[model samples]
Target: MTTTASYEQLKLLKQFIDESKTIIFYGGAGTSTESGIPDYRSKHGVWTAMTRDGFDPVKYANPQFIKKYPEKFFAKNEERDNRPVPEPNATHKILANWEQSGKDVRIITQNVDGLHQKAGHRYVLELHGHHRLWHCMSCQREYLSEEVKRDEDNIPRCFVCEGIVRPNVVYFGENASKDTVGKARRSMKAADLLIIAGTSLTTPLAKRLIYDFEGDKIVVINLNEVNISPLKADLFIQDWVGEVMTTLSEMN
Candidate 1:
């Protein structure tokens, strides 16, 4: 249990999941923040480094620019953020285990850390892609996440084509993988309950996905208030995600 969770709250949480058959857990960068992965939009994030470097993150990952001067972008990436060793937190593990019980409908995440997948969540719709895996832009050859991790470079490259390898993640202007978005929408529409944790509900599709669900049951756990309007979440707890999900898992 987290520092904030009470026995009463735990009971309420257990009851919440118990009644819902089809559940979809939507999360954001905040979901992996506790695991030591800095969310790019947070106060202490890669964006701050980009500011010091005198360029916006939006411009940095531009497709045209990346293809034009790949070396510069790749080099800057190496200097800026090469620390990608963040592991799955307790929350990630529990969510994955929840799926093992055949109860978790789907885990829709905005994070690129690939923690949930590593934790063994079988049904996942990674809307924004993940940082762990990489693919050759030229040949479009897929590489295992471990292959990227073994390489010390920030921007992991493809050995065969020697082309610029991009993380599977969706950049600022880049579109998401059509397959991923489709699955997320389908799962969300079928959800009886939506448990959202560790997200500000800010940024592109994070908040918009909530609108897909017509069901009244929505649970949100965030450290700060989300940008969206109105007191509509069925359960809102401003707290740490790792602790909350860990507590909820132990209830059953």
Candidate 2:
């Protein structure tokens, strides 16, 4: 399903990669869609499904919701933990190869899936935190996701402080990790080319980070149009991230 226009855009992206010494791959939920993960804003995504069920996904996924309805929150977490783990797709492999091949590449992702690291990417900044990691709310002790399974009452408790244990993800209405954000900002400022992929830039923090890039060029590849004002993409490809990345790899 690769169109001629998409090939042309791939050529441009290749040229950008060739010219730039430092590159940043800023990714979102759509980056994992090819790996059987659903995006948040897409029509059939998590948000849409929540809305269809008469629930506000943002409210339901918030940290406050965890306190107000511990059982419900933990139940949702249990369900998510029970789902099959998704594997890294072409996009992740391509980016990881770029980094391994000595292309000064860094990844700044808004996804909690940890697919980038799963694909052997070393320089990844998880802006949204990771789901595979868990932490105690009171003791701040960390644990792997598997170590903190919910009990029969649908509550995962920290063994040390007997406190609530939650995934190490930045929920809606929660501030992102300042350390991660600062590191990402530094990478953006140092990058010569920034590739915005798989995201509509709907999240305010993600949008703000995009604006922080004082890079030489910006390349956007997504299945939808990106309408961020005052910031025009040097190359925009309205296509699948995996397809675009796969083609780009082939070009090289």
The lDDT leader among the candidates is 2
lDDT per residue as tens, model 2, 104-195: 99999999899999999999999989978889888899998879856678798888887789989999899899999999888988999999
The residue-level lDDT of candidate 2 at 116 comes to 93
| Model 1 per-residue lDDT tens digits across residues 72-136 | 77787665366756778898888877778888568888877778888888888888787667788
TM-scores, one per candidate: 0.85, 0.95
Kindly report which residue pairs in candidate 1 clash with one another.
none
All-Cα superposition RMSD per candidate? 3.1, 1.4
Model 1 TM-score, all chains together: 0.85
- Candidate 2 lands at a TM-score of 0.95
